[model samples]
Target: GKGSHSNDVGAIQADLPVPSDVLIYYYEVTVKDAGERGVIAVGFADVHFRLSRQPGWEPNSYGYHADDGNKFHNSGKGEEYGPPFVQGDTVGAGIHLENREIFFTKNGKKLGAAFQNVKATLFPTIGLHSQNEHVEINFGAKPFQFDIEGMIAEEREQRQLAVLRSRIPAHACHDIVCSYLKHYGYAETLLSFDQGAYTEQVAKDEETPQAFGLEDRKRVRNMLFEGDVEGVRQLLIGKQPQLAQLQEDPLAVGGSGSGHKGAPGEPFGDAFFHLSVQQFIELLRQDKIGEAVEHARSSLSTFQGRSHQHDQHLQDVLALLAYKSPGQSPVGQFMSTAQREKVADIINTAMLESSATASASGSGSGSGTSAGAGGG
Candidate 1:
């Protein structure tokens, strides 16, 4: 946050854990810098692969060979194993299942790795750690590729959250909701918190799975570049919360950028939570309150910018929360005992008694509700 890009130990260690049984084919990274340069250093800082919790806490081989294969990606090998990485580039490395053969590629060239048979195992997960700044993980592909945009958007939030928590003063009571949402991409919406007067708009439709794929995203992202109001409106109207969350940028904290580029000085859809809560509010308005409530309840579990799975989850939670006999706060009625305690400690004292009573009655294991709403 303070200086030009440099190696961050925390960021490197915060690797995402991939579940077992699934294999990640490639990783796409969006290089960010003064020059938009993409860089992947084999041996030096290409990609880090660690067995989720492999025995003896052993570390897997680096995708590039620091000693044997090639340090700066010598292209003479004619695509033997993996290719070398360069600045401003998004490279892919194959973490082979058998023989643990690691191959590298940059613009589709051959670079090599040091070890083989380094079994790609984890503590029930795989973490695609990028030593470089813009690495993204991709498991499935072709007719059904991974959620690339969502992945990067999410990692960006993680990086930003690390920035926010580290820079801001540590209060006795943390405004984690803001920080959490901020991390989730609601920086601008949260920033709007300071500006007292404004009306919030609800997105009309739920985002479909196909819309999140590469093709649809390409159209949507390009449209923002064209700045077409009607097109943007139609696209955003009624889009799912998950897709909407993708629009928020964690780096932004919010001001006046309203109306796509709303009111002068206002924040753009830079804050992720703005999209999320907007989706949240929509579900509530549609009488699908429980889905949104449950979403907040299992906040940490569902990552922002991944797939519509979490959105579906959000829908269900919001719907369920709506059923709480009115005046029955979603937080009070449906939240887990632990989640209730979390809210109790931070929001209000009255929450304590209500939460306790709700806990005793076990009101959260909601019945009659199929998933997120009045079926919204």
Candidate 2:
């Protein structure tokens, strides 16, 4: 059926509204026949849009007419836009959610944005007027004729470049990079960065009281990264002898081990737990199942039911024993160097937090006191 009079236009809408959560949404329509008057319309409209009127004849609707090559919005009057679309022409309509703009394409060529400030839950709508007008809609079920992916990529790159171009304090940037390198056990890189980028800052850092024992922390971090869990444990305990005392209490070791309690040896309890787990994993890697089981029983068994994360991690680690080739197991990620690095990072953070607490308390107690004086 076709329109009999000027206002007798027929339009169809999608079952659901255009998704608003994404950055952009686009659809295409292929005109099967331009019909007698070639009065076809493709665009978006709100729920209140009338099917008996051209899509852009009323409020909260937008459309591009095939006959006049004009864009219309909120009125029957249209403005000059793209070329007229006809049979076999693939026309596209897209909504840019972030920018609140609507754009159209004709035969895979974009005609630029036509509407802005769109703020409604609109549906993809198409209108047909006059006899024999027909169109088939494609809601991204097939490849898009327009280069939408390229457009998205270009937008993302532009945003990233904008962020990189923003200015920040030079010292702040240096400190952030330095802290990152130290936290990740990149000792060589940190040294090169300090010597190369901020030679003067390195000298100033050496004179600061907080810089004391930085080398020891780096050594412990390196040991952990080298898969020497016992070495890290020994080094940490040697530096803070109270860590050995805290390890005797299972509750202290498992309870809130990840937090800095401001108590001597309390923070190290969590670090010790991580080291024990790593030690068990190392024994398993060496094919010493008996030693690994004994280690888990003596060290990790106490951590059970203490925390959900610990329990789940312990379960995953134990599952590795079931596979003859543990590297092929579902929990095989725990067997990689990346796992060791992750554990090292946790231990390094605990050490840094504990040291910061010691430094803060030491300065509060007296001016002449050393940072480690509060650790005892």
Candidate 3:
């Protein structure tokens, strides 16, 4: 059925309340039946405004005219706004509330902003002049061809980032990045970080309490990789001065100097047993049966009665001796490259734990170290 412009206004029978949250409100119009150069307008107007002329012809209304693709508002038709609407062409009108602007699209292609600073409450509207000028109005009951939600989210994300920028100091954030770069052996990145625009703001004295510096971590990690247990011991003692005493007299066997009261054999006890086991295993791998036996008797024997894990590991190391080709037996699994890697991991983890314990003690006296799993 064709809607004739009885008095210039031909509003759709339905009206919708536009939501405030959405960045833009969209309406699509499709011309179905019309005369040559037929005039059809699609836009928004006050619900009470007579749809006498095109939506924008009245003071509180806005419209995109299809005849010349001109914009109309407050009884005045403005410049070209969109492609002329012919039969079967869809014209979409969008009301952007954020900027108080309105725009039109011809066949889904934006024709640019049509009006600015629109503040009046309006309803979806359309107008036609010809008797057979038929048009369909879609108030978004179906999915839009454009990704409006994605566009809105992207805009909102920018706004949120702006808010964050105003709150967090730039230097503090970059310092974390500096730490990460050093951690991953990105020396050039670390150097470049110092040359960044934030260099002046990042004072050297403003050190974020890093438990283990990257250089120290890398040095210790390399020592362990090369089966340098003595070097690992020296590095740990140097980083954690207290460890020097703990190494001489392990905490588990009532070493009185340790600050905590029986803080569980978790830290020092675990590190001692694992390192001693690795030394014993290394001796066996070198086929120094006599030295390996002496190491087990002197270092590994203390852990046998300390914990079940220690006892189990000790037994496994002893089992390695039963095979004529000790490196070829099931117990020889511990002699594989994987086992050597585990020794490095144990040292790294101990360094982290010791650093964390020291920091959490609130002494705030030593360098900070972190534990991270190394990728082989």
Candidate maximizing TM-score: 2
The total of clashing pairs for model 2 equals 0
What ranges in model 2 sit over 4 Å off?
A: 1-4, 169-376
Return the TM-score for each candidate structure. 0.23, 0.47, 0.44
Query: Candidate 2: which pairs clash?
Result: none
Off by over 4 Å in 1: 1-10, 13-25, 32-61, 65-84, 109-114, 120-376
**Clash count, predicted structure 1:** 59
Instruction: Tell me the tens digit of each residue's lDDT in model 2 across 78-190.
Output: 99999999999999999999899999999888899999999989999999998988899988788889977547644653454345335455577699999999999999999
> What total of clashing residue pairs does each candidate reach?
59, 0, 10
Predicted structure with the largest lDDT when compared to the true one: 2
lDDT of 3 by residue, 1-376 (tens): 2334337545552456566777878878788876544777788887677755668778888888777777888866476555677888888878888989888887767788888998887777777776677887776687655655545544554454344224346577787888888889999878877787466554432323334544665676567557777777776655545555555555532234445542422365567667778877778877889998897777777565666776788898889878778889988888876676676667655555544444333333323322211211
Candidates in order have lDDT scores of: 0.34, 0.77, 0.66
Q: TM-score of model 2 relative to the true fold?
A: 0.47
> Which ranges of candidate 3 are over 4 A from the true structure?
1-9, 167-376
